[model samples]
Target chain A: MIRRLLLFSLLGACSLPAQFGLFLVQNGQDVASSDQTYGFGTKPVGAVVNLEFHLRNSGADAILTDLHLSSTDFQFIPSAPSLPQAVAAGTALDLMVQFRPGKAGAATADLIANGVKLGTFNGIGLASVTVSMGDGSPVPSPLEFGSVKRGESSARTIRISNGENSAVLVNVGTRDKTFQVKPGTSPIPIAAGETATIEIDFVPAADGPQQSALLIDQLVFPLVGTGLEPPFPPPTIDLDRADLASAQQGKLTVRLASPSQATGTGEVDMDIQPSDASANLDSGIQFLSTGTRTATFNVNQGDTVAHFGSDISATFQTGTTAGNIVFTVKLGYFTTTKTLRIAPAVVGLDSSKAQRTSAGLDLLLSAFDNTRSATSMTFTFFDQSGTKLPPGAITVDASAALGQFFTSSDLGGAFSLHAFFPVNGNPGQVDSVEVQIVNSAGTAQTARLPFTTP
Target chain B: MNRAAVFLLCVAPAVAASNFSSPLVGLTGDAQGKLHLVHGVAGSFVVRGAIAGQALDWAFAASGGLLKTADELRVLDAQGNVIGRRTASESQVLLNPRYAFFPETGELWPASAHRDRALLIQSAAVGGRVIALGPADQREIVLAACRGDHLWLLTFDITSGALKHESAPGGTIGEQACQAAHRAALLVLEDRVLLANAHEIVIQTSTGQERRLPIPRNHGTRIHRAGEDTVEIEMSGAPSFVLRFNSEGERLYELPAAEARP
Candidate 1:
């Protein structure tokens, strides 16, 4: 050992208290990756990554002592070589070191190199290599640890409706010991446009506010392997705009609020409960009449509304979405809330009647509002035999002015020519007139008259 | 208003809207048995048995000869009776008293009494014509007759008021490729003419829209009638010309090849 130490390192000039320690790159390019580097991945448990390293000239000065590299995770592929001699020469001609990775996590090992027996450098040459181990996933959507309202269990299906790419496997986990998970697995592969279900069962410790992690791991997309999931997206929820008001003008006009449905056509579960059920003075709303209700109004294409007005003020019940609805109210003037529904129907055409025109028949029409005020009404003529007549002009009533004539300009394919009437409903009342339908041959027929109040 | 008032005021006296739309399709004819007509649309109505106490009725879906214009057909003083006929022709067919001959599908003189500018329309294409009677010493003469595919109009002499018949140019003579039954005289339905070009069919419609119907290769001219108002056309094989289509093309019908209207 003395002669060998002399020949080992010829330089013994400058030195520290006891030379220094070592950290070896080991004898490896890691080409096959069998030579373990300080990285985390698949690992053979307990099997050391056989590797070694030795020191040449560690520094400018000659080192004083035997050098060796060792660790619990590493050793020579063959075995530990004999202790090396040093200090004769200023430096070593050849040097080598070796090592292997430990468990798949941050591993630590001290590389003992160029240390004397009674030297502090024994532990001083400590170097630790850390590699993190994990099951990778990114941007995975997940649900809470099967925690949902008792009645809303079906809503617990994890929604992956908006996934752009398919995933190989999705990992659902819970870190909480108390919150158990089912279908213990990760990375359930799914094709594009497919959804995967991860069933889990949980029982709260106390039924109160139970909290636990719903971990998502090992998400494999089209070509990507598992990676850490992106930070969870901010929470979201459904929002509704609530606005309530009393029916306008002692009247209740119900109409389809949507293009597809008219008023009174939709389902409405409503009740007029008295704030004070014991208050015997108040009777719940009873219905008097449904009024004139017509149906088959094309929701967007047709108009459907129901109108009602009363002396008492009351609240109406309806669905959350806007559009067609039924109206229910109290029967009499003085009463509690009552419900009435005009089976969804489209009422009077919103358009006003136009001015005068003739169709070879002597007929006239008049319309009015509730106040007995005169309003314009459309008049049509038919030959004596009730056959539709062609176009002719009729004098306009002096009472109504040309308020941008309903302009019966084109009767379309209807034989009767059209003219706009400009009557003000505030003056008098009139509805419509029908020319005689009987032929003018030998017999004479009476003309038909049509009228309305409001 | 109270309940009764509201009820009375809001409700209108309901009047059942009458579904009266169609009109009487019949028209009265004239005092004399001079003229007759069907729909301005050139269709023929048979002199079916009487109904509603009348001898004739204007039937729907009638079949008949082609009229160049709607104004040319009329109902005279008698209701539903055909009256004096008129046709808008590019050339005038002068009627007079003379003897002429038709060579297209040879026939002889015809006889009838018509007071107006009655045309002794010697059958050049489809139907025959009416003639005028002459003087006391002799009986009315019947000289030239109808020759199908072309006409020889014999205009009577104006001065003496006699049969002064003469031959004049009528118009082109051919059938549409699809339904050649209805003859064409240039004036009938020119706008409905669909030209079969080297590769396609093109039609100039009445609404001033031009439409080109796609035709498969190796198709020939075969106009098919599918309904009272619809027509379908197909070509044979590898159309030698461009296909053209037109819906405005006047509709024409005719007897079979054996009965080429004379």
Candidate 2:
């Protein structure tokens, strides 16, 4: 009899209706209380949607003990009353619910009070904006702009499409001054389903790779680019002749490995340093212009080589006294120089001494010439029979052989040229030798010297 | 003070007779006889002695003294002998209270105020390169820079690291302000900007009102702030002298170069 009594009480509790239920409220007026589900409508992601409702007590006086929301996207307005409040019968309490979707998709939640279902909420979220390359290609997270010349600009365009159902204002910008958004590309409202283009320019003020970001609303797109040094490299100056002669006109060829990509003017200066204090370099060196200590050469755009006089080679006359000329080519931050050792070109053979050994005849010759570099020295040998030998004449490249001797360390004028010659075969067979010396300017020959066997 | 009393008070120590007779050469031939400033001082002063055969473009009073040509910077001692030297290719020179600025390198020396050893103050903060710089006080410097079509006036506080910027449209006044002759002819106060040239001194207020004070026979002149509301105009001549004036354009007194301390 007791078990039957408990079962009756449980059945009576299960048959009772909920005391609190929620009713839709529109524009501060009661709309309906019978609908099971309420739609919050579509909203752009990151936007908020608020739905007003009234929590009405329809059964009897009850204490509202608890409230729960099923989804994190939904929340109760902080201005509402606390839980555990007593509600009189037939009375209604105002309540506000807000839904904020973080991503594009369908969102839903359930409203429950005191272990009883009040209502269900649903909404749709849409992406606010879409971004892509100007050519309709997906933009990489960090858009890379290869190598851009320093002090120059490279531009690219991107398309920003609005995916929202209503017009929305969008702002796009970069924090770095090197990366700039072209004018008239931002701060404009984009209509729904419409697209706009933004031209971004990367003008690196300095050299090296730089990283920055493009901010569109709350979204950040990374960007990267490298600035290359100016394309103009130091030029190379080559002299027509290795050894320049005093009081003589010579050619200097200015060559550049690459073409100039910059527009403007550049100059090449000739700095002269003469060992002789009385040497007047200003009056001697002349190219491009006359009677000037420093000669100027101009470089134009797209020119691989600079022209001074008539061609790539500039004609400059050396001073009467020997000296060193430094040709400096300057283009922006690049500077290159070529030094030419100028000396008198006179060549002479002073004396020749010969000795007989077991191997052959060794000859020591001494000569004095202002220009130490002699182009060639020829030795004509004759046997005791007075007939030319098998190897008629042995020629030596004096200039190449003496190149190592005359270096930047040499500072004296009218240097002496010393040379050794060894004649093979029987020393007794060698009788006489006539030597001829040749240089850039004048050539000199020596009288045939007689040799006697020991 | 009377001119005689001021001269007696500010008379410099006895210098070599050769110092006054030597000829002064400018960076350019045309710049000869023009007035220049010795920045890097507690306050600025005119260079009294001649710097002959140096072909110097500008000079500063720091680490004893420094003179710069187009390609070299030479440090001089109290006895006027070169003690240090370095290769420096600079286009413009800027002076502050304690530091001197050289071109090709945008940095302040003595390395006391900044880190990273570089400051873009020339371009980023001023909108262009600093053409002229003058001391406002012990820790403040007033500078001028030129941008696209505007001239900027910037004041920097050394201790607090605060910077104030003002700009005006470029036209006739802007061109005169940038000239090398008027490099030290700018004085910025709390409410007005003072710019001086050979013929007149222009006073421009923050409210955009402009006033002018004619300077008679003031061919080579430089303007400096003597106090909060007073300014001094130094005229270059046989004997350079400073003419003090109030903000109302009233002449206060004249202090000759011989009487100037720094």
Candidate 3:
């Protein structure tokens, strides 16, 4: 009985319970055994840091279990294996830990296994600031302000937002004198989670594209702007003469004078309009030989005026119809008009009954007075080939000589008058004569007299 | 006297008495008629003789009533500088042979007995023979050439020798028309250049604008600027007629046609 008791005591001593102890192995070394803490260094705010914690069971018989994180900032991804995991003695188990601090401060968490602290994880979050446009859009580098006219200014506002937990001091400026910042002071204070407004102004002194930059402390927001000359005012057009008689020529003028001190450029359009639909006005006017009714003329800087005109020959064909025709001249917003009048009295010559005298030729001319009395008659001679002869070749003898070869009368009715042209040369060689007769109404008529010399 | 001298003496009297009629050869002289031409001994031909000096060797035929010679025409300036030369054909009649105007240069070149090289004014743009040349303005020269159906007017800067403008008046002037243009006379006014032909009168302004004024009754062959605002045009037909016009192309007066004896 004593021998049996001794064997049982030896077995009981050999079969004692295994002690369970946990440690954290980092970089293949026992960090929790040497110290109790693991540092993750400082990181920017809103940044995530990954760390690996190796939990080892240093005891011989017990398994690792009940692994957890004390702080919400420190989390185990995929959760440390189920509680009571069989981690043999002198074996290791891997736990992935993530440190994501929401603010700019130190974050600490305890790594526990089997209700015992394994190690402590410490991380620090940094602070930062960001710049954006006033409209809440991110600031673009080298902002462009397309084209701008001379003496014109443009402005843009920017917001400096402090994204950190602490307030930040911001300074805004530009290297160019053409670019200016509103409030004109540096070190603008912006609270955490708040923004400070800064305005950038680009005033150009000359026309063209310009550039500058906005300095927000160490950060640079490139700025650009263009300067252009102000637009020119429309040109003014005028007619030289306000009234023109039928068969008379007149001139039209286009002047480019702007009261705004701007130089005029581009082309001016001119149009002709007649009061009577039956009266054709364009046919009487000629411009650049490219048709008459409408024309486009150029106006350059320093050049103030251009002139154009047309003869009123077509108005004469309006024949005894007294009316007005208006010429509309337009240059940009400026317009002008001129009036023309056609009268009704007609006076002409009859050349069929031309008689040849011994010394010269006698021409019988008939004058008709429709609205007024016929007053005068004038005569001219041309060869069959339309050449002007010498003055000594012919002599004119009229009853009432108004001038050298004109006869003056006040015949109210249609009357036939005699004008003698004494040819110094042979009358047999006579070709043709032209007669122009005028009435008291300032109306004139012309007729060509073809003669057969006998 | 010798036989030749006696023959010359016998013809001299008749030559001095012969009266030159229409289409007469124009004589060159100063306003005082100091260097006028006297009749030769023979009536069939006339020699260039000064009024109070020895006679010249140049003689022209008197039968055609126009200047005709087998030699070329040489035009000289007042200082006796040669200006132009032209070869005269048998069919060509020299009108106003004593004085001719180089309308291209607006220079009055006088005819001389001397021979010189001719200055031919031309333009490739026209592509045809130059029918007329005149001044478009005081500083510009105009050349009018006629081809098959084209009438081209080319203006050149006189000082720079550069072509400033070119325009082709749309119309087909046939070969007959070209001949008529050759016989036409040119007159340059202050603002217009008048070219009078046998068929029509073409007036071109200093601004390169052209207008063809038709003579419905008769054909014009000569033109002369009578006054600042007047142009005298002469017809080509038997009954001599003269038409006067103002600068604006208005007919002022027309003289009755008369028989011209040649």
Candidate 4:
């Protein structure tokens, strides 16, 4: 009977032994590993997948012990992870259970935290689970950028989807000044269950510059996803600057006057402020009635600190004409106000002075005072039409018969004098006369040869 | 002991005197002009010229009192003199180092580093056959020289690797041979091709042509024309200066020693 009793005690001791178990941990939320139910892809060479697990104190008291298990494909968390406070009852700690994807193909691995046979606790303490890692479908893809023109506006959009349980942020930017993309109000937040579309507009200010980089960022729970986490698209992009000119009425020309670097076909955002307005009133630029005139736009080089102005000219029509526009654009952190003054329209033709035979000829233009402040002036030329030449600014009058010159239309050119209406291509000779100028101040000064043709 | 003798042998007084004062005669316009003057210890100097806006090439080298051709510019000694002067062709003075140009080949028999050496392409000669005389490692010649009476041009062919020579009638070139290292010259024109020696300019054309030239005895050059024969040769001013006939000969103009411009 003693022997039987000892045997029974031994059986009891065997049954009452401490038990242990190990399990899997957290994986990304809603990882739809299309083919694999466990949400794992083909484990490429040298891939590690961290599986998360939760541990609970099911024992009546805080059971402190080391966990031990055997598996080549699995790994345990910090050894003897902080033991939960002496559990008065059935309290628990959601400790992490990690399982890294091993090699490709079907593989199995066991994980151990402390020294313990994790399988031994299957029916007693907890349960043990096996994990497999492999390469799978449903991986995040990249975004592509399209072409844009110089001096013109264009836009593009990248589509990114969140296949995980958590939301993610998408950011966009480039380093080159040749292109500018409209910044969004805030980082685009894409929900795990939804897709976010990013809109990027670019205006290339220079030529041949490219725009690249569209990034997706967010936290990814370990063990929940397949394949690589958050891959980046090719940042290098091809920015085509084929369209430099606007199709509309006016021509806008922007140039980099300093640094002497050659800019290619593209529009770049330079100074923050807009272009100068008064550039249209340039005076020194006078176009020939029969040919194209010279108009220029000026810019000051940042290096020399000297100011340069560009001049442009167009033949006078009923209205204003346009030429290559120079951008006196005030850009960047500093805004400099450029002054553009309308130079007095050129009075001289190809030549300033002309020699004619003494055979009293008809002069074309009536000379007037240059100092005249009023919008309109009535000046008179002597019947003899002879005046001594003087220096200084003078004006031209329309009605006064300074000389007889004619063309079909009003062609803006230096005033000339002639006896007959222009029959052929010639526009007669130049006309000159002495004139008096009257201003609002009642000040009068006379300049000689107010309107003389070159 | 041999090195000392070699040093003295190399140190011998430079014999080739650069005629810098003479102007290139018979050349017209900037394209066919004389090569600029250069003073070097020793090395190959490129002679670039233009005639009617066309370019030409001429290269030369000088060594220990003996001029030679080179593939790459020969290394210079401590005094900046050509270390080794290349000796090529039987008629080195007139062949390798072109004395004059041949109408058939347009090749300068003898070429000059600046004036006398074996340069494939000459800046003052025509453009055609380009040959080079530098290193044996080179497969072809490197320079081409074409000289016309009114045209002087030279070209450098990074390709073909050769130098040729060409010329026209009534044109003046540097017909002198350089015998010393570090010696360089200029091809200038006045009444005709004249060589500047020390302070005096020696006429390369026949003495008869020199007698008729306006270049008077004891007269100095004020200005020079680079191979321009279109307009009459006029040398004006000075008591010793007289209207003399500028003789014509196939003479090469050498740069004079460094001095103030006349």
By DockQ, the best candidate is: 3
iRMSD, all candidates: 26.3, 35.3, 24.6, 36.8
Ranking by TM-score: 3, 2, 1, 4
TM-score of chain B of 4: 0.23
Model 4's alpha-carbon lDDT is: 0.27
State the displacement of the C-alpha of residue A56, model 1, in Å, after optimal TM-score superposition.
3.4
Candidate 4 lDDT over residue span A1-454, tens digit each? 8996665455434331132223334453322223222322333324554444434444444343344345444444554364312322344444443344332234443334333333311111101111111122232232223344443545454455544455544443444333333555444565765665544455554445354443333221111111111111111111122222111111223334343222112211111111223212222122112111222223322221111122121111111112232223332322223222212221211101121223322222211111112222222322224532122222433222211211211221112222211112121222443334333334333333333221
Give the Å shift of residue A376 in candidate 2.
21
Docking class of 4: incorrect
User: Per-residue lDDT of B1-262 in model 3, one digit per residue for the tens?
Assistant: 1322322232222112111111111122222212222111100101133332221111111111112234444443322223555664333322222333233433322344332322233435346655554333336556555665455666666445466787655422222335554435655443555666665666666565666666534544555332223344555541222233333454423221111100
In order, candidate lDDTs are: 0.27, 0.56, 0.47, 0.27
The value of fnat for model 4 is 0.00
Per residue, candidate 2 scores C-alpha lDDT tens digits across A231-268 of: 67567887888866553456677777778665444566
DockQ-derived CAPRI band for the predicted complex in model 1: incorrect
Q: Give the per-residue Cα lDDT of candidate 3 at A93.
A: 77
User: A290-357, model 1: which lDDT tens digit per residue?
Assistant: 11121111112132222223211212222111122333322112112223321211111111222222
Cα shift from native, residue A293, model 3 (Å): 5.6
Per-prediction TM-score, chain A only?
0.29, 0.40, 0.36, 0.25
The runs of at least 3 residues in candidate 4 whose Cα sits more than 4 Å from the true structure, single-residue gaps closed, are A1-213, A218-256, A260-454, B1-89, B94-262
